[model samples]
Structure formats: structure tokens, C-alpha cells
Target: MDFRLTDDQRALQAGMRTLLAARYPRERLRAAVDAPHGRSEVLGTQEGAGAPGVHGAAEPAVDRRLWAALGETGFFALRLPEEDGGAGLGLPEAVLLFEEAGRALLPGPLAATQLAAGLVPGAADGTRIVTALDGPGVTAHLASADAVLLLTGDTARLLPVEGGTGPRALAAAPFRSVDPLTPLHRVRELPSPARTAALGPAADAARLRREAALLTAAQQLGSARATLALAVSHARHRTQFGRPVGSFQAVQHLCAQMLVRTDLARAGVYAASLTEAPAEIMGAKLLADSAAIRNARDCLQVHGGLGFTWEADIHLHLKRAWVRACQWQSTEESEEFLANELLMDAAGENAPGVWWDTLGEENVQA
Candidate 1:
């Protein structure tokens, strides 16, 4: 199938790419990495007037200024209704904005805010807001949100955080994610006085996952591309055995494999973004997770020992990929889900004949 971008979509993508490249260049990224708190310095301030907690320990405070900037740019309101102070764009536009965010490795409560904006009353206008998701001990509930949207299960009332940021819970497992630029938080405790409201059975959750997965894939694609570039550049400069490292066939093969994976993953993500099917989205997520993780590893391999050192930025992509691979869903879980769906689609029955016999019959003596 021909998956061509419309003129408007192309324009939107170009604009976003330009904006991200200017705002989130490598210098800014390096600064964020070196910060004492491992968060974007632009988002360093706390929410309330009183003093915030230790900078480096907790989830880094939300960057309200950056949030406002994103909001003004119509990013937060991308998929919202025009009546709700949004640009009245659709999922496709949202995907483009998010893909840029992935590439830039932008941080904060973006996914949560985007999900909350339209569902929460006055949220679209960026007022009186609350947002949280299910993880670990947390069930599919919206105790803190003025409005809650559930993705997989039934909605329930969740406890609110006492002077805490949002819903706090423990991570189901330890995740050393690749994109350290985008921090991950484990849910520790549930909030009390769980206030809640029903938004009906909305597609908010599924859409959020699909968007997150596709955008993450795009980010991974960017990381893969960046890593490959870095590896090639290093190979050209670094010499071994009195020759450029790039001259080595092994290094050449690794670079070729990285390129192939990245291109295939990018295509999968783009295709998934154009579809609303849950299966396609899941498949895209699985393929992207594999591509990002493998590509990062290969890039590191290409860089040899230098890549393992802290000074090298290769670790950043590695960490980011690790975190994102688990977020929304793990690679293993997504693959299992996709397999089940495919089996069901194949009439939920096993093949009648042997694998080779089925093909052999078609070319038989007749």
C-alpha cells in the first residue's frame, strides 16, 4: 500500500522538525544530561510557591514554562476539539508533533497532559487539571483527575497525592531505559479521597497508547539514525591496524544492519500511525522496540570501548530505549498480544497439513 504524506502533513512535519532542531539541539541535550537532577534545566522549578524537594532525587518538577510553550504552539491541544481551545487537528497531526518530541527527547508530563486535556473539564484551556495512569499497584482508576480515561480495564477511584505531584506508585519492574532525557517514575503509593468522574467509554486510552507507541518508534528511529551517524563518523576518524576502522568488513556489516533495522522500523511506525487498528499499533510497537534496542546496542558495538564510557552520548540512546521499550508495554507482552490477535484472525485453528506439504502440493506433478 502507498503510504504517502499529504502536503499539509509534510508541511507540519517539516515545521516540527525545524522547531525541535532549534530548541533541542545537542548542546541543550548535553546540558540537561550534566545537570545535578538529570532533568531539563528549563523545567527545574517546582509547582507550588513553597520550596520543592531535593532536585535530583524525586521526579523532576514539571517545566510549566515549557508546558505553556508547547500549549501555545498547539501541541498540547493537537487532537482536541476546536471548541475546546484546540486547533481541531486529528490523531495524524498529534502523531507528527509527538514524533518530533521523541526525536528531541523532550520530557515532562506530556503524554498525561495530552490525554487529560480534552477529557478533563477546562483542561483543554489549560486550567484546573489532574492526570494519572495505571501501573503496578494502581488499578485502572482516576482518583486524582478531574476526569479519567481508562485504556484497558474498568475505571475506579484512585487516592490523591498529599502535596505530591500526581498519582504515585511503584514500577512493576526495574527499567534502565535508554532515553534518560525522558525520565521514568515508579508508582509508590496510592492517594486518598479519590475524587473521580466518568468520561464514558472513550477511545482515549487506546489512542494514547497508539500515539505513544508510534511516536516512541519515531524517537527510536531518530536515535538509531543518530547513533549510526556517530558510529560512521567515529569509524572514519579512528584508525586501527594503520587503517580507518570503517575499512573493516565487520564494522561495515554492523552499520548496514543498523540502517536496515532503522528504515524498516520507521516504515512500520508510519504505517501504524496511519491506521486505527489495535493490532497494527501493537505490531508497530513491538517492531520499534526491537529496532531501537538492537540499533542502540549495535551503535555501541561500532564505537567499541569508547561507547561504554560515561562521556560518550551512546549511553543516552541506550537508556532511553530501555525505558521506552517497557513503557506503554514491554516488547514481550506486545508480541504476545499481536500473536494472539493473529491467531484469532486466522480462524483460531491450526494448519491441517505439514508446513512443507502445504507448499509442496501447490507445485505437485499436476
Candidate 2:
């Protein structure tokens, strides 16, 4: 695939970016963080959202209107088939939207919800919030999710988070995320006699994982780019001694390195989206995590003491980046996955037959 944005895609990107910048301002985000868990004013939460319908759903952290607005924007239904009342887009378009969401620091289980559009009832319309889970034992956004897809050893189970009386008790309690705006609740303790709406085999689970990693990487890419721009902006304006801070050679070098990392990561993410190779996808995840985390830190360094201040908005990006870096696949896991792939190739036919066959097939494909 070309990876170049088409006319429609560019317009979509610009529109989404403009909307998020206007609607989800820094002040609004801060207010959301300060507000109570289920009553975030920024998101226009319901009084006691505890059911499927959004009309009277109370205690919702996300704004009902905002969720509807997202549905209108085709956020949740982006990749679902049009025949199935979806936008029927593809992975590329979906990733673009995700990138903008990350740039705006939009909170919630975004990737999971998107995937849920096809599975969870009312998800495509944004009436239901779906959390795509990586593990069965524990997951995030449990309290907010209408449904949860638990992946355990290549099998996927679509578990309902709601019950006839009210929302099901899927988790033990909510945890305050490092990124205050992004509140998290894990499924530490499960309500007994759990029920699943559907189930799928290993292939389905694998596909879900791919989508999760790819979309997450896109989000990280957006954050990296945003931080790069921030550092550049600060360097250009903030002054030290007599000249602008950006005029300093050290600042220039830092900015250059940030740009390089961000661009390389973008390339990797875009490529991974096009090609479904496991190694390539893992490589993309590695690059993206490095770019987001490293760039956020470097941007902070450029900002000096101001970066450390609570009032500064830059730290929000850094915190979110830090949180995301650990989720999905950590730096260590990505390295190990890639390292093992390399080792398999290096081993060739020297020892294990299984490893040799896998390496041999991969070589043939390449």
C-alpha cells in the first residue's frame, strides 16, 4: 500500500484534529481529571449511568453526547462493514483516526471500543462501550465497558459487563491512572457465574491482537509527533542568556534526534499496518514505544523546570506516553519477541526442526 494520505484521508485528519483541539481543550481535560470518577463534567457524564441505554445511564465517566458525536464521526464503526451498518473502512483509515485521538489525548479504551463495534451490540452506535482485553485474569476500563473481550491463550470470549439489574460487577475497584484524565479500573475480582455472549478460536484472537497493537502504535506515533512539535515550539520561543533557547546547538541536536525517532517510528507503524508479518508488527511496536517515551522525556528536558510543574500540559502527554508504553506490549516484551525471531533465523537448521521449518518458510516469503 502507498501509505500516502488520500484527499479524503487528509480532510478527515484535519477535521478530526480541529474538532478535538476545540472540544477537548487542556482546561477541559484538567477539569475531567479533577472531577469525580463517574461525574466528569468534561465528558457530560450521566447522573448514574448504570445501564445499556444512554438516555438515563448514570455515573458514566464519558459524555453521552460526546460518544454520540464520536459515532457520528464514524469513530467506532470505522472498520466495520458498511453492509452491517458500518462505515466499512480499513485498517489504514482507522489508524489515522486513532493518531488524531492520541494527539488530542482523548481518554478511554479507544482501540477496544473500535474493535467492539463489530462484536458488541450498540457499540458501533456508541451506545455501548467495549474494552478489548489482552488477558483473561485482568483488564482495564472494566467499570466503564459495556462488554469485554477477554483473550486467553488464543481464545476470545465476549463477556458482558452489564446485567439485568445493572452493570455487572466485572472488577474489584477502580485505580487512579498516572494520567489522571485516563482513569482505569481493572478486573481484579470477578462476579461469580460469569457469562459470555460469544466465543471465537485462536485466529480471531490473533487478529484482535494485531489490530490492538497496530492502533496503539498509531496513537503512540501521534503522541511522539505532538511532543516533537512541542519541543520545537518551546525551543524557538523560550530564551536563555541572550539568544532564543532553540538557537543553542544542544537544543538543535535534541530536536533533530526527536524528529528522527518520530519519523522512523511512523514509518515502522505505517508499514506494519500494511503488512501483517508478526516480526514487523513487533518491530513497529518497539519503535513506537521508544519514540513516544523518549520524545516525551526529551521534550520535557527542553522545557526545563516548567516540564516538572503540575500546571504544565506537557506532562500530560508524557504521563500518557509512559502509561501506554507499559500496556499492550512493554519494551522488554517487544525486544524479546524480536530477539527470539532473530535467534530463530540465526539458528537456521543447526538444531530444532520446528524452528528450522518456521525460519525456512519465513525466508521463502521474504
Q: What TM-score does model 1 achieve against the real structure?
A: 0.75
Query: Model 2, range 38-82, lDDT digits (tens) per residue?
Result: 333232222123322233222335555677778877888988888
Top lDDT prediction, candidate number: 2
lDDT per model vs. reference: 0.59, 0.72
Tens-place lDDT digits, model 1, residues 1-366:
666778998898888878767766778777777754453232222322122324433333344455555666676677777876788877666766666676666665455557666666544544433444544433111222333333443432322333433332312121222344443333454333234344555645555656656666666666666677787898899999999998999999998998888778777777777785666777777777777778779888988999998788888877877767776667887876666555445553343211222323332121
- Alpha-carbon deviation at 45 in model 1, angstroms: 18
lDDT of 2: 0.72
- Each candidate structure's TM-score, on Cα atoms with residue i matched to residue i, is 0.75, 0.84
- lDDT for model 1, on a 0 to 1 scale? 0.59
